[model samples]
Target: MHLGQLAQITIYPVKSSAGLNLTQTQIEPRGLRFDRRWMIVAAATGHFLSARETPQLLQLLVQPSEQGLHLQAPGLDLQVATPAPDGQRQVSVWDDELSARLADSETNNRLSDWLGQAVQLVYMAPENQRAIDPRYATAAAQSVSFADGYPILLLSAASLSELNRRLLEKGRGALSMARFRPNLVVDTALAAHAEDAWKRIQIGAAEFAVVKPCVRCVLTTIDPDTLQREPDNEPLKTLIEYRRSPKGVTFGMNLIPLNQAELALGMSVVRLA
Candidate 1:
């Protein structure tokens, strides 16, 4: 079996916000602790908002706290409560309408004002569950946090190298992996997009099922540094030339960890199945 090393780990404590890279992380079914546990939702419709629409949401910096995550932007800062809110609100993300705990009004108010919109901060209570799309799952019933669907997203450095190669060939600058915002990055001596065929992989002591190719979206077009979409419709436009699919243009693999374990940088990534 060809072996690889887990080169990096990242967690998005709040959905659509910036991600925090870690040399080590806790692997769990609901995803790394605080990963996408909180999300911003539109108050009027209870529908979740993402950087896909609110590119500015990318500007929100997340700092974890014992109480919860501390959010900062421009000149604003707010400490969100860690405990799930007592009041529940039904929020929709993609095809799922999940039960989410509403944040305190003050936190919501401040964030809404900062974003110049009427929105609310919400948390995914443990009791509330969203199942993964079963066709790709190994378990009869597996759940996820507030992530788009799966518990983890994995990418290989070679894949990025290949994509960058294509982009450079077209006179475009290379893009950063941050555009994909993966949870685990593997440095494997495999061909580009090899993860597309991996049924399962082991990182440290944790086994993860490589479920599906993550469908690319407009949010990827947004530069993490500038929070602005590429004027040329770039990477996405280029991706369509090669990565298009019936489901959508896919750029990375989504994973579901099978057990709890601590993963650290430079850990071996062994293909298990």
Candidate 2:
């Protein structure tokens, strides 16, 4: 397995929604340019929202426009401007809250009904004030799409296989890679910390440096199909016992591409000393 060859490339234009697969994708400092750049919000409270709290957001399908953004679900299709209005409102992600824009009335109504709730849309704007967590200072205060806080999440296929082996031993059903929601999935011949070696690796025409190990979260416990939090927490517990980091048990490496290059699935990835 090679690092450069993309085993899979998926994007959630709308946070918590289904991912779109692409044979080739652009790599930007803050992850794919249009990635989680836009998010649906709560119209009444002017708060930024996500599938983390309401997993139903996963059902919304987003259609990318040259400028406008459109989302459609069960029976609703809503279209709005790319950069939301100028007026700012306080928006929160987990514990961090920041200034963001609330979508206009028309768009909000459309999305709310589709979601079977009252909600609006919000877009993260370019700003210089944001900063990364102290532990990930190496990532800097770069602008990020709607992705939690990190730019990208990378996972190794072999790592998942190893975990599945353990699951089988415990008589647990096998899990799919989608459960991890990785932007870059590498197939590493090496053992643990295989991604750590990505510090300087070439895949196809692209080169990258591992920025930091991604900390696992409760989101991992949420099953995409059922959209319900798992009870056993077997994988997470197993990871903690085997893959705990100073922050926590980390399964993937968040990476930033060092050089721009055309990348495609099945391309060759080489580790550089």
Candidate 3:
């Protein structure tokens, strides 16, 4: 087979917000560093969430930095430290309760006001423990922080094109590439499930192994722009019809890097299979 290009790269420092676009990015076992490493959870219920369930979150812009995170809200500009505040708060990701730090009172107030609800910003602590679903025997016990479910989500440009073709046929607007929220997007000119043939692949000098086929969820049904729930998006609806896995309708690929270096934009990728 011929070589594949690095189609697209994205990082969501905070899940469900506008993602950072990259020409290329590193692939790591825990995912892109500082990516989905922190999250905001309901203080009362301890459940983690994104703008999908709460569109108000889009009002908060999150940018990751070496120091921690630079947050911009309606009227607030705050820098949350990496260690964050020491005060402990109970938080949950899916079903895991974790000890976490509240960003700062001022920041919290701005966020709550924007959200129009009382809520706390929970930073994923180094001490916080989160494990992947046990049903994925190979990925179980693997650590995750603010991520939705699996460690990574991969999409192919070809797949998006396929979806777009159908959309154009129906005279619908072309979908934004961001809707799928993939860490790595490949130019797999091959047919659907082409990535499944990739047990291992190389991006630039970094090597990655496919962990599993990423499972789809309600998150996909949520409009990334309006932040409104639309359970009938065609691609998502079609995914359920044709690609449903025993785990559920699966799309993209989840991968773990074989190296410890960072990947950048414009890097060349070659499939090693």
Candidate 4:
């Protein structure tokens, strides 16, 4: 049965940085190709940095290239070649500790200057296997890139529309879908929050298990456009009023791909369970 059409596909090549919208992409075991394959970490602590603490990261635009990534921020424009795998370094992403390849010192210095803080850009090579949380993963070997937890996050347009409706009723302005930063946005005819009940779904040729409801966080409160935090935490504050759960205030669904396939805009989406 047709539940919706794939309306948007976004990949954050560099975690917490601006995302790139794609018309089509290949789905790999970790996630869409190059998705969150790179990340910025604090120079001293080797801990990951995200828009949650430094909203300025959102202003950094990253574009993948044949050679590596082209990053643009404020007055800086840089083309960083893919770091050699030999430059392995230990980095921490929340509770996951993994090895990542460090970019050259030149690239690191430039980025540090741009952010006004010492930071390093690191790449997650294919060999760096950061396993998903055991309880939610379908397989013991299931791995994720540098994403918060899951490989993919799926949200329905109807869900955002419903949220907007509630925001409007509260005299708050509507928010953009970018605020949620989903990898897949399905335009469905189903009622708001209908996706909360979906256990499995097929998009284009790929099948996915809806492993968990994505817990909302402070990152969602950051305005993608201006790279500023909402004074009153409008949507998140509003979401807390009703979307709260034992897991936390939730919005989108976290997914683990069951197979490799391609996803394209306008592809038919079917709820499998």
Highest lDDT model number: 4
Off by more than 4 A, model 3: 1-3, 24-28, 73-76, 134-141
TM-score of each: 0.96, 0.84, 0.86, 0.98
Model 4 lDDT tens row, 18-111: 8889999999999989899999999998999989999988888899854699999888899999988799899999999999999999999999
Better of 1 and 3 by TM-score: 1
Instruction: Work out candidate 4's RMSD over C-alphas.
Output: 0.9
Measured with C-alpha atoms, the lDDT of residue 181 in candidate 1 is: 91
Better of 2 and 4 by lDDT: 4
Instruction: Give the residue spans of candidate 4 off by over 4 A.
Output: none
Off by over 4 Å in 2: 1-4, 44-47, 84-88, 94-98, 125-129, 134-141, 259-261
* lDDT per residue as tens, model 2, 1-273: 344345877777766777766678777655665677667777676556766688777667776654767777667666777654576677666556677666677887777777778886776666513344556545455545667767677787888998888888888888888888887777657674577656666778777666688888877777888889879885797778788878888888876666556667777767774
- Indicate the worst ten consecutive residues by lDDT in candidate 1: 77-86
Residue 213 shift from truth in candidate 2, angstroms: 1.3
lDDT per residue (tens digit) for residues 168-202 in model 1 = 99899999889989988999999988899999888
Count: clashes, candidate 4: 0
Error of 1 at 92 (Å): 1.0
Candidate 1, superposed: residue stretches over 4 Å from native = 83-85
Ranking by lDDT: 4, 1, 2, 3
Writing each residue's lDDT as its tens digit, candidate 3 over 90-144 gives 8777666667766777766766776777777777766776776666535445766
